[model samples]
Target: MGSLIDRVGIVTGSGRGIGKAIAEAMLHEGAKVVISDMNEELVKQTADELKQKGGQVLGLVCNVTVTESIEKMVETVVNSWGRIDILVNNAGITRDALFMRMTEEQWQAVIDTNLSSAFKVTKPVVKVMSKQREGRIINIASTSGVHGNFGQANYAAAKAGLVGFTKTIALEYASRNITCNAVAPGFIDTAMTQALSQDVVTKILDKVPLGRMGTPDDIAKAVLFFAGPGAYVTGQVLEVNGGLYT
Candidate 1:
């Protein structure tokens, strides 16, 4: 039997990229997953695709920056599945600029989506999990958060905030049998990194001893460890960085 057979999970920003990979991994392990994203069409498409693979999937349109939208999604999930066994706070965006050049809007946007959304989404989910006495929460953080990046002050701050949030949740909710952890992915080959100039990409790759960009599946594998076999683990940030020490 799969490790997460019959479990219900929510993966935010799951319409594509790393978030999609996490959802796919959970579904492969027999979890009923919720494909939550702001893009309605993408959500529907991804859910349909996963369902075709025999996954028990639900598609929900969620604006992670809006608490009302978040609450509605949580309500719908609970109404359909009766309980939430896992949540992956994977919704994030990068507004790349040096600190001096970054605007308030860019910083606020990243902070709201990446860090504050976790606070909003987890509150209600935690209430549900507290009653069930078990749940797993994995936040998608970044290596930029750990070591900082030149053009990602806003993104790095938000992710660093997420790392703190994960640890705090882990400590506060352990008594309720809920585990919270953060997965810090480094240089994953997603559309985000693909947007970079070749010169920048080559410079970044030169720092990696592995000499290659990490794939979304590499991050997914680390997430799966927390969701499945790593039951005794919590409050930790696992860096899946392809041996690239910043």
Candidate 2:
């Protein structure tokens, strides 16, 4: 049996990228996973693809920004699995702009989608987890949140807020045996970063002592450590960058 055999996990915004990689890692460890995304087609496609690999999986449409949607998601998972053992708040979007060029809409959208969504989803999930007195909550943060990035004022603020939220939630739930932590990735080779021009990417890589961009799997490995049976760590941010930001 896998390490997480019989465990039930839900990963939001898991249709693709780092989120999807996290879900896949958990599945390999013997956990049943719910793959959630706002895009219906993406959810279905990812769910089906993962299931084909012999993992127990479910796909759900979840808009983490909406409280009602989050509540329903928690309810559905609880009803199906009888308990939730893990929650990953991985759904987020980027609205890149300098402070002067950034619109109120851009700021609000990023905050709501990145920071607020974690709160909405975690609130209901925490109720069940608190009762069981056993759970893991991992938030996907970014290095941009740690060190301010160019043309990413909104994204940085939202992700930085997530780090604070992670700490508070960890402190509040520690007594309940639910640990919360954040994984801050830097210059991962995701679709978003791949779109950058070579010159831009080159400049970004020059700062990294390792001289390479991290992969989704690199971030996934860090998350799996937190989810594992041996991790006593919580309320901390693990930087998955290749020595880019200290």
Q: Model 2 misses residue 10 by how many Å?
A: 0.8
lDDT tens digits by residue: candidate 1, 1-246: 889999999999999999999999999999999999999999999999999999999999999989999999999999999999999999999889888898999999999989999999999999999999999999999999999989898899899999999999999999988999999999999988899999999999999988899998999999999998457999999999988768
The residue pairs found clashing in candidate 2 are none
Which 10-residue window of candidate 1 scores lowest in summed lDDT?
A: 222-231
Model 2: which ten-residue window has the lowest total lDDT?
188-197
Best by TM-score: 1
What is the C-alpha lDDT profile of model 2 across 104-214, one tens digit per residue? 999999999999999899999999999999999999999999998998999999999999999999999999999999999999998778778899899999999988899
Candidate 2 wrong stretches, greater than 4 Å: none
- As a whole number from 0 to 100, the lDDT of residue 239 in candidate 2 is 89
lDDT of 2 at 159: 94
